[model samples]
Target: LLADDGGHPAVRTGADRLTLTPVAELGLGLGEGGAALTVLPLIQSALLLASAAGPATVYTVDSQDVLADPDTIRA
Candidate 1:
């Protein structure tokens, strides 16, 4: 699964069995200096549970890595 840090389109192919949800769109203004960090773990746990039960694989791409060219990663 490939996820970007918001505003970018996610690449998905019919042959690929994965689901990538970009939580970047959630924004970072839930509280003072983005205190939503407290809920991040819970969100990840829920995603893990759903991924385990489904045929698709779910993974997170760091914001920095997501900005890199996919071709470069392949190399």
Candidate 2:
């Protein structure tokens, strides 16, 4: 998964951090400029947890739908 803080200009991880730098030469197949990328830590965490458990399926719940009928989830 890719995530951006949308506020900070820096990308950081528990083990390492990277600062985006500009490409000196332009139009030299350099694609974009000063691109920022972030790899979500949750992916690694989920993989580790899933490996321990036999097998599992992941699902996303919509907030509005859940709010409309929270009791169904509880039951």
Candidate 3:
């Protein structure tokens, strides 16, 4: 799905996949699916913010670790 992004349009058709481009990029002649993708409006957190700044960190943990010691994980 595509929606206005600061006047430009963006679409995320799959996980870890997103694009901010012009309408002509749709290549409608390729197939009907491409044409339909432009119809729906999409709003997702995965979109980038041009004004955002600051340090950030991400962590991945196993469910077992949280089950074993929830307090430490919270800290």
List TM-scores for all candidates, in order. Answer: 0.29, 0.25, 0.24
Error of 1 at 71 (Å): 48
lDDT of 3 by residue, 1-75 (tens): 332222222333331265444333444443435444553432222233422644455666668887887654431
Best TM-score among the predictions, by candidate number: 1
User: Model 2: residues >4 Å from true position, as ranges?
Assistant: 5-39, 57-75
Off by over 4 Å in 1: 1-30, 55-75
Give the range of the ten consecutive residues with the poorest summed lDDT in model 1.
1-10
Instruction: Report clash pairs, candidate 3.
Output: none
What is the C-alpha lDDT profile of model 1 across 1-75, one tens digit per residue? 222222323323421345554443454333342424545776789889998888755565566676775433322
Assess each prediction's global lDDT (C-alpha) against the native.
0.47, 0.41, 0.41
Better of 1 and 2 by lDDT: 1
Better of 1 and 3 by lDDT: 1
35-64 in candidate 2: lDDT tens per residue? 222123454676788899976555566688
Q: In terms of lDDT, which candidate is strongest?
A: 1
